[model samples]
Target chain A: MTENNYIYAPSEHPADKFRCKVPMKGTRQLFVIDGGVQGTAAPLSIKFDEGNCSDEILQVIGVRTSSGPKELSSESSFSFGQNSQGRLILCSHTFAEDPFITKEKIKISLAPNSSVDIVLMQNEHNDAEHISEFEIDIQRDASLRMVFLTLHGGKISNNIKVNLNGENASCDLNGLYIVDGKQQVRNLVSMNHKDPHCYSSQLFKGILDDASVASFSGLIHVWPDAQKTQAYQENHNLLLTKEAKVYSEPQLEIYADDVKCSHGATNGRLDENELFYLRSRGIPKKEAQLLQQQAFAYAVLDKISSEELKERMVSLTEQRLRGEFSKCKNCCKNCC
Target chain B: MLNIKDLHASIGEKEILKGINLQVKPGEIHAIMGPNGSGKSTLSSVLAGRDTYTVTSGEIEFEGKNILELSPEERSIAGIFLGFQYPIEIPGVTNVNFMRTAVNEHRKAKGLEPLNAAAFLKIMREKMEVVEMNPSFSSRGVNVGFSGGEKKRNEIFQMAMLEPKLAILDETDSGLDVDALRIVATGVNKLKRPDNATIVITHYQRLLDYIVPDIVHILYNGQIIKTAGKELALEVEKRGYDWLING
Candidate 1:
C-alpha cells in the first residue's frame, strides 16, 4: 500500500547476486533489500557488519522472491528470492513488527543444488502483521528444514507452503507458539508432494490461557506419481483456563497406493490426579500447577537453536502462564 | 486420654455405629473386636474425622477438650492418629516430605518451633529404625507400589514420627504376615508412653496375642454388646463372634 517501491532489477541471475548492496535503518549491522531481480542467474551471499547499518545486532523478517535471488534484512516488513537446487536453511534471529498493519509477502524459488536459510524474529510492541509465502522447488536428493518460533507478538499468523518437485527430497517443518491473555493466534501450513519418494513431517505445539484462542490446521497432498512417500503430522494444545479454546485439524489427502501417511491431534487440560497428589503432600496448589505447566512447555521451547533465545523464551512462557501479557498490552511480543 | 459417649455415626443414609461408648486412659491399650459390618473400622474413621461418615449424635473428648468438631488435619495436630485400614497410595508425594510436613504442621500448631531439614532428617532416621523399614523407602512416593506388610509398617512409622497422644490402629494386622505383624506391633509398643494411649481395632483375636490389650469390647449391630478384661478376647476367639452376638 506504500507505493510498491521495492527494488526490482533485470541484470542478475538468482545464483550470482550475493554482494548486491541494500539500505538499512536502526542500530543493527545487517541491511536487507526488499525488491526482486528479473533476468540474470546467480547465487546470493549475505554479509553483516558495522558500515551500512548501525553497529548494534540485527534480526530479519518478511522474505519474497522474483526472477532472481533476493537478500532480505533481518527486520524488514517483506522480502522474496529463488534458487535452482531448492536447499534452504533459515537461520534464527530477533525482529520487531506491528500487529494491526498488513505486510507484503515473502517468496523463495530454489534452483537445483541451491539451499536457503531464513531466520526471522518478531520482538516488537506494536500491532503488525507478518505474512511469508515460501515457494520451494526441491530437486532430487535435496532437503529442507524450516524452523519457526513465535516467541512474542500481540496477534500472530504464519502461512507456509512447500512443494516437492523432485524424487527422494524431504522437508521438515517445526513450530512453537505460546499465547496468553486474550491473544489470538493462527497457523496454516500445507505441503504438496508432486514426485515419488518425498517425505514431509510437521509438528506444532501451543499453550493458551486468559480466554485466548489458538488454531492450527495442517494439510498434506500426495499426487498419483508420488508413490512410497511417507508423510506424518501432529498438533498438540494445552488450555490453562476454562474459557481458553484450541481447534486443531491434521489432514492428509493421498492419491497413491504405495504411500504411508498418518495424522493426529490432541486437545486437553492439565492432569487433576497429578495435582491432587502434590497437594496432599502440603505443596500449595499454585506452585504445583506452575511446575506442571513448565514441564509441559519444555519440549517445544527446546527446539530453539539459540541458548540465549531459548532461555528468554522459557522465561517469557512462564510470564505468559502467569498472565504477564495483559500488563504489556502495547509492548512487543517479547514482553511476555 | 480419649473418651466417647453415646457416639452415633452413619455413612450416607445408613447408620453404621449406634451409641458407642468407650474410654481409653494414658498408659493403657483397648481393642475393639467385631464381625464384618460390626462398625469396628467405622469407629476409627469417625475418630479420625474422615468426611465420609456423619456423626448423628455423639460427644468425643481428647485430653479434656471436645474433638468431634475438628477437621482431619486439626485432629491430627491435636495428637490423634489413625492407621488406615486400607492405606491410600499417593503417587509423586514422597513419604519423607509427607511426614516432614505433617510433623512441622503439628509442631507449628502447638506454638513450637519447626525442625530444620537436617534435624528433621535425623528424627526421621531414628523413627524409621523403630519399624525396621529401609531408610531409602522414604524417598519414594507415599505407599506407592508398597507391599501390604510395608504399607502397615509405614503407618506405624508415621505414628512414631508424629508421637500422637492417642494412636488408633484400624485393622493394622488384617493383611500382614506373622513376621510383619510382630514388627509392626513392636513399633507400636515402643511408641507407647505413660502419657499416651492406643486403641487397636481388629476383627480377629490373633493380633491381640502380639499387642496385648488392657481391655476388650465386642461391637455387635453398631453397639458394644459386652466389655471385659483381656480374657474376653481369648474367650471370643475360642468360641466365635456368634457367642457375643447371640447373648
Candidate 2:
C-alpha cells in the first residue's frame, strides 16, 4: 500500500519530498489513531459492521480538533459491511503560515446492500498546502455519496478514483471550491464502470477571486461489458476578477451500447439578470452576491445526509465566502 | 407620490425614452400602454435604476428624493419595486430564504429590527395566498422550473412580500392566462393603499379590466402622446394604437 500510494516522481514533484517527510516542524500533521502527536505510528483503520452506530462514534472521529492551528501526515483506510450506515468526516486545516501538508489516501470498499457518506473538508491556512488522494471501490447493491469542499487553502489538490467493480453499484461525487488571493486548487476525478447496470455522477463548481487559480478534470469510462450504465458529469466555474483563471475538462469514453451518458462544462462571471433580480428585491450589492453564491454552493453542501454535518458545512462555507476567515485577528484558531 | 419630469433615457447610445412626463399619486393606479418598442418597458427599467439604461436627461423623484442618483438596490430599499417582464431563475435558492434576506435588508435600511423566523414565515404564508402560490414554493428555488404564468405570478408575489411604496408592473399580463391574470391583478389591487401607488405597463387592455387604472397614457415613440381615463384603454383596444400613433 505504501509503495503504490506514496511513490511520486521526485524529478517532477520536488515538493512531494517536503510533504512526504515525517516528524517535521513547520508542518501541520494529520491526526492519527491512538494520539496525533508527532512521531505517532497510529493510523485509523475502521471497518464498520451492522449495528446501531450513533453520532457519538462520528463525534469521536474528531470533527472538532483542539484549539490552535495543527498539521499532520496520514494514511487512513475505511470500509463498511453489508447493511452498515454511518458518516465519516475528514478535515484538513491549519491556523497560521506553518504549512499543513497532508498526503491522504482513503480506500473505501462497501459490501452489497450498504451505503456511507463522506465529507472531505479541505480548509487549510493561507500559507498551507494539502494533497489528498482517494481510491474507492463499490460492490453490488452498494452506493456512496462523497462531498469535497475546498474553502481556504494556499495550494490544494484532490485526486479521486472510483471503480464500480460489481453489478448495480452507484456513486455520487459532488464538490465546491471557492478560492481567493494567490491560492490554487485542483481536482481530478476518474470513475470506471466495470459491471452492468452501474451509475456514476459528478458535479464540481468553483468561484475564483483576485489572482486565484482552479482546475477541474473529470473522466468517466464505461467498459464494453458495462451495459445499461448511466453516467453524468458537469463542472461550472465563476471568475470574480480579471486575473482569476480556471481550466475545466470533462472527458468520457464508452465502449458499450445501450448506455445513458452526458457531460457539460461552463465558466463565466455571475449572471447579470440574476444579479439585477436580487438587487431589485432590495438586497445590497454585496449581500446579493453572497446570497447567490450561497445558492450556487448549496447544490454540493446539501447532498450530505447528516443534518449536523450539513449545518456545520454550511456555516463553514458561509464564513469562508463572507471573508471572515481572511481576518487574522478574528480567525478563531479552534474553528473547524 | 412618484413623479417623472422630462425623462430622457438611453441604452448603449440608443435613445429609448425621449422626454417623457408622468405623475402618480398615492392610492392611484396609472396604466401606460403602447405598441411594441414604444418605450413602455424602458420606463419601468429607468424607474428601477437598472444600470443598463442611462438617464441621459431626466428626473425621477420617489418620496421626495432624486431616485436617479440611487443604485438599483437603494431604490428598492427606498420602497420602489419593479415587477420584471421575465423573472430571473436562480437555482438552489429557496423562495423563503431569498425573501427573508430581501425583507431583512429593507428593514435594516429603514432602521427597523429584522423580523424573526416565525414572524417572517407567517407573513410569507399569508402573502402566498394573494397570488395563489403553493405553500411548497417557499422551499423551492426562486422561479426555477416555473411556467410562464407562474413566473409572472411569482413577481407579483415578491411585490406582495416587499410591500413597496411605488410598484411598477412591466408587461405583467403578457404571458399570463385569464385565471392567472385575475389572480395577479387581484394581488396588485389588494396591496394598494392610500399611502402607496402603482404603475401598470402593458401592451393590451386585458389587465386593466381587473386592476382598473384611474388614468391611461399612450406612450408612442418614447413620449406619452396622449393621456386620458379608463375609457381611453377601451378605445385603444378597440381601435388599436395605429390611430393614437397616427394622430
List model 2 lDDT by residue over B34-56, tens digit each: 99999998899888888998899
DockQ of each: 0.07, 0.78
Top lDDT model? 2
Top model number, TM-score: 2
Interface RMSD of each: 5.7, 0.8
lDDT of 1 by residue, A86-145 (tens): 112232212333123334355544434344333334432324334445455566655665
lDDT of 1 at B4: 94
TM-score (all chains, Cα) for each model: 0.55, 0.89
lDDT of 2 by residue, A196-295 (tens): 9999999999989899999999999999999999999999998989999999988999999989999999999878889989999998889889888888
Worst lDDT window (10 residues) for model 2 chain A? A16-25
